[model samples]
Target: VQLMLVNLASPVGPPFALKTVTPSAFIQNMLQSTEERLNNTTEVNPPRILEWFDMSNTLHQKFSLIHMERPLFQPFPSELVFQNFTPLQTYKLPLILLNNDKVLRHVKLEQQESEDFFVVGPVNSGSKVAPGMSITFTVGFTPKENKDYEGRLICVTERERFEIPVRAIGPRAILDFRDEIFFPICLVKAFTQKTHLLRNIGNSQAKFKLHTQRPFSVKPSFGTLDVGESLQVTVSFHPLTVGDHREDLLLHYHTGEDVFISLCGSCEELDIHLEPECVTLKRTYIGLTNVHTVSLTNSSDTTLQYCWTMWPIQEVEEKNSVLLQEEKEEESKGQRLFECESSSTAAHHYSVQSGALQENGTTINCFYIFVVQKGEIWPNTTAQFSIVFKPEEAKIYQHTVYCDVTGRESNLPLTITGEGLGPELELSYSLMDMNNVFIGDKDQYDVQMSNVGFIEALFRFSVPDTTFGRCFSISPVEGVVPPGASQNVKVTFQSSNLGTFSEDLLLNVNGQPHPHTLTFRGCVIGPTFHFNVFELNFGDVAFGFPATLTCTLFNTSFVPMNFSLRVLGDGSGSQSVSSSSQVSNLSHKNWKGHAARVRPVEFTIIPAAGSVRAMSDVNIKVTLCSNTVKVYRLALVVDVEGGQTLQNLCDPALSSEAVSREGVSFLHSQASIDADSLRITLHLPDKEPHQSNS
Candidate 1:
């Protein structure tokens, strides 16, 4: 008898408050939603099951013992309780929900009425929790169509677990724990914690954390949207006492899961609001205009109380049509813009300041004063400045502005107006080259002056009257040319140090008056001198070969000379001669003492046509213009080629010691030429047939 009807009522707080008629919050929310559907129940083993691992350690696997489930027979509760059955409250037999052992499934039994609590401590703690009581043995079960089912059912009370003041409630809190109560599980955890046709489901945020631990307050609605936005949604549910007026309750908006719908009275009220975001302006004065907006969204999760009214209907169509921009190549001096206007009744203000819209519009935005000058026309870069509103020219009026573009902005309707004015008086000028007028080298050239225009043009700078005092020299000698950036005038020149160092072009960029003339160009700098002709001569020839000499190139330069020529020889048969007349790009040739300009020489003695000249023997040569020192010399005496001598000459052997066959005057050494000293004579005839030496 529910422990003697909770030991005759009389309980209160912290005993886990339950009394309210044994439904104890409906059996503590059905044992915590049946222990969250048995923790996502996952042992599903019916249509087939054998499992048994262990072949690990790469198969011959020794440490064996792998039953991995294969023997689970009903019973599986491990515990469940909702205490506080009255009697001054203090009942708690949930000893952590019958501590284990379950596989149960359809094992029905019935018989209530019987509690007789006699003695124990928690019969509301006033003591006496019945030392013995528990007659209704088994109670119920709803399992028949079992395919895998499982167990656990300990209904204790027989002898009520030891004497006086014990056995607090049925199952006597699991009668002293532990006893062979099978533990196999894996038949999808034996039908989700002991049989119930199993379709287990847990973790819905852990079952909404036990009703968010009972102290409520959450206001969430629905979301997502972005089509020309304009929304307001709110949804909140509360049945224990309403706060944000539960929007007519009846919500199953699962949208699918067996579908559901029924909301239109502006969604049952509660600050609904929806509709009011018309934005589609797509313009094109030459690109960019499609995504106009007015914005005000807040799709919901409970939170919306906006404020802003006025505008249920205000019209004025006609949005886009453009294709203009191209006409600013100079030649249009009719500019005007700078205005301000006003009216009486509640609104009106027209203003103008444009002029640079020409694909052929020719000076617009009338009623002028000085809109925009200096090469003029630039106005509309998407109309960076526009405030047009016209009316008092006779009647009607209305004008508005708060349009900054994407959509969803509320109140808008005040078309256009016209009347009060004020703002104009502009000017511009441009004349550059603060660095383009150059001509220097003692008599100088500096004409760098700038001021690219924007009002302030009045300049002066010249040197023409037959080029002033000859050549150039302009300073402030011709004033006033200002209006837009640029200034610098100094054109000096007087270096008559003549001949080959030139540069008289200082007319590069004179003051500008036609085609922005600030374009000066000229570069002249001279003086590098270091010329040649230290000495070289080619005169004295014919010895059957060898000879060449050249170097009369005096470069009193003004710069300009590049050369190359080298020829040295001592290898008999003589041969070595180079010419551009023997080297002379005239390293600077300014020859004043010789009237410069010497590029024409001749040196021909190229008569060494080979035949090995009897194995060669007769040399003297030198020719250098580049490999330095000595520009030319050749005395390659490779003679004996004309009319032959001694049949081609061959007599030159001197090995003393084999020179006497009988002589008288000692001291004979002959055969020389350029080693000087000659006078030879000897005659012998008398081989006993006439011998005579004289």
Candidate 2:
């Protein structure tokens, strides 16, 4: 049968004319074609073209068949098809098939295996393609070697089979680098260098070009690298400013590929400083040494060398008065120096050194040099040394110590200062007491002010303007005393009142802020009486025996006095003295009362009642008689009849003691007098054995 082919589908321009062909010849052509087929059997319809209708129009036919020209069936000709495909060796390319038929058709697309290449998709796979549908096959082009690779994609259908040839080229001359970024630090005005490796991981040789910015230099800017070979590119950074700097280092290959590397750096200024920045020596006494320590630190990246020197500070003394014109000129000049003695001589008064005693009691002297040589100090480290000051004068002196480091413009200054003490005022006594002085009496004493120091001492005395000022006075209140010499100042006191008086004498030394206080005290007296004896001690008396003694009384008053004597006894004694009136009324009363216990002691005065002239003396004899083997004490009170009472007559001169010479039990007696009467103390020995038995 004869068939007529026509294209009713949308055409680019004019419609194609109809052409007639035999069905047998058409089937033969379709079966022999290389296009993909749906099945292996040759029972298939002739090639035809159909006008696709909008399925939404229900009246239109869903399927139809018609014949078309050669150009209508094949949009891409053999020459136009991509017979060879080259891709990067690192990646693969997918193979695809498109169906331009107006009716549905079954197709199987797959790859053909070869020794040089392998297909990833299944050649026996099948799928149905609708009109205008494109399906991707599992077939892909993968380059196995650097050489050209050949492969084929087979499309199988029921009527015919088709083959697509493919060729791939592996990439050559690929460029790579070990690092994509480089960072370094550079000092100001200095440079840092680094190296980067450029590698060719590809199969062929690679050509590269290196590039960077200004202040960043690279060596071997352009070079070639073989497969599996690497090249080192050195980069140097020289920063002019003190901050961060950045640049791009690029490697451009001849194959139009680029590798980028970042160059980063920072610049900083170097610094070194001393910990304290200044050293101050401790205060020292004249002829004594004081030491202080200072630390030197290096904070920079490099090592340092240091040196030091010391010198006394010079001061100018102004002696002459300046005129108005000269003063104006000096003010204009900022500062003026006057003609005076040079302080350079003061340098001899002090010395600086360093040393300390070890644990073994041995002294290790690390003496400081006046001018030190270069001493090396590493970065981030500290060094310490001592400065000793020994002052020889009594004046405040200062010196300047300069520490110098290599490459430093100026030296570090340390101040050494100390003061010396001159002659000091030393008092023989800081406190004094002018013992009791009678009322309205005048007394004089002296205090020695000595200069214990090496220089002369000048002092000024100040006394309080209170009662002390009126009652006490000093001679030579202000004066100068030579070194090692003493000056005595007389302190005179005139007692104006009767109570106790005390004062503090203030002595101020020249150039001293505080004054020394010396204390003085005394008491004043009024009209009083004196006694030759205040206490009487009776020696040991034999038991049942009597002992006797005499006490003399003196009248220190200006008038005659009448006196009465009485004897009193302590309660512990067997014998007690009777009351004066009672004893006068009944003389034998005391003896009668104690007759059963023991006989009471007896007392008598030469004149029971007597008178004494002014400034005269009286004698009284006391007799003692005891029958018991015990001690007895009697209070002997000699009272002035109708006269002023006398107190505190227990004078040390009148106190006397007597010892028992016969080995008999001894009795002790002591007498003390107050304002009204005399108090006597008696001690009785242990009762005698013979008396107890009797």
Candidate 3:
């Protein structure tokens, strides 16, 4: 028999060379193959080693080359590398063996004893492979530790034994997650969700299964993650009752690794409290807005949304109409619904309107009650807002307001009550007439101020800016009057100067649109008085003798008059008397008579100073005593406190007289008497005692 050997070391050497081999050796190889096939236990027994010689005659060794065929059985993958896998997790891969020769052959696959790697299908017993055909076998790898694993898969045939390298990597399974997750306070029957990253930070694949108890759940409970891969995991907390909730999310991996994530959450019921259930506003004036503030507090852990429900306009109007009808009916029956006397007190007649929501989203027309603010109230916080009440007319307004909140079973009701007052004050007379007023004297008139409105009236008199206003004064300039009651006000007029006075007085009342104007008209005049005679004469008086005369003073006015009499040239006399008599003496110069003698004259007037009664008169007696008997002139003047003065006029012609032993020289007269003043004349005694100049 001949054998062929190929040289692999020498490039230029012969590719194949025939070699001489003993027939016994060839026959021995055939017999050994037959025995191996008959026993079918080559997997248990190791293959026999054969020695051969190469083309260079160098000694070498090869395994199982029985038939000497060129390309016996070949495996397509000369080496097998398993995918990276987790510990204790089975991973499988396919290995294909092909028959490359033109003959049929029996093939078997075997692997070295390794606890982590193994091969399947006809390991001990062989299978037949046709020429140019292939056979596939599944190789599984199971790693026991976290490390790289290598093994050999041997493909045994009748002609040769081929070795295919197999390798596998043991991977670590690591899942990255937060150790604890806390959820915020939530309302009962509501759910809250939290998202976290589930990442595989290891060098191999990771498979996990998540589990949790009640009130806690996770999305993507079980999943597979590749190396360095991550996914979002959502954890939800849904509570059925109000309380604190605690749970653990268990993440179980196929590699026997477990992780626990703590979940904490709480739930609470909705509660919102109102500070004041009823609101009572003070008495408000008509056409004025009064505000009252109220508070809404949130007592729960969650924020609450709240809004005030306004009373429906139609409903309010209907209620007001009904109340009006009732009032009318009561009036018809002679029974007053709201007593005017009670209006100033605590009793009130109000129409209560129920709170309701508008279905059509119409604008709220709250004519009486208005809400200033509405919105959300935070947890453990209080919200205060204004409730304004403005009345258009005098009446009582009562309303119920509802506050609708998120968590309350029913709407909160707030009662608001207010009274609108309009003061109706009137004067008894529009004009106060004092037809004639005496100067420097006070005149008073009584006036009535009545309050006819349902509410109490507050009134004040505005001080007038005119000069005449000072002459008039009204008592009780400011006062409060009850409903249906009247107040008496005394108006007095006092003036110093005489003139016609007229003034408009303003009465200002609360809640009145305009001030009440009252007019006062009057005329002021002085007292009237007159003298009966223009002159008092003591003529032809005897030397060292006395002469007497009489004069009358009259008062025609309603007031009394005061009078005084004095003789000119007297040491004590009035200023007007002295002034007038001095001028008269000068004018009556009569140089022809005054050079005769320088004698003093004296005059005495009875009742010199006295008051004359109204519409009456008083008589005055004037007596003159002269030593030289020269003509003397004087004036009598009267002065009243608040009336014009009255005086007698003197004639300068008769004012000067000459006294001598012989008959006095005749005195020429020039001055004339006037009607403004009372004049006195003194002369020598005349026969019959001047016949009493009465």
RMSD over all Cα atoms, model 1: 29.3
The residue ranges of model 3 lying beyond 4 angstroms of the native Cα positions read 1-372, 375-421, 433-436, 462-473, 497-500, 532-544, 556-560, 567-602, 612-618, 626-635, 641-694
Better of 1 and 2 by lDDT: 2
Best-first order by TM-score? 3, 2, 1
Better of 2 and 3 by TM-score: 3
Instruction: State the lDDT of candidate 2 residue by residue for 170-196, as single tens digits.
Output: 344655553335546555434567776
Question: For model 1, what is the error of residue 105's alpha carbon versus the real structure, in angstroms, after optimal superposition?
Answer: 16
Runs of candidate 2 exceeding 4 Å displacement? 1-419, 527-694
Summed backbone clashes in each candidate are 101, 14, 14
Residue 253 of model 2, lDDT score: 62
* Per-candidate local distance difference test: 0.23, 0.51, 0.59
Q: What would the TM-score be for candidate 2 when compared with the true structure?
A: 0.25
Alpha carbon deviation, residue 474, candidate 1 (Å)? 10
Off-target runs (Cα >4 Å) in candidate 1 are 1-71, 76-78, 87-453, 456-488, 492-694
User: TM-score per candidate, in order?
Assistant: 0.21, 0.25, 0.34
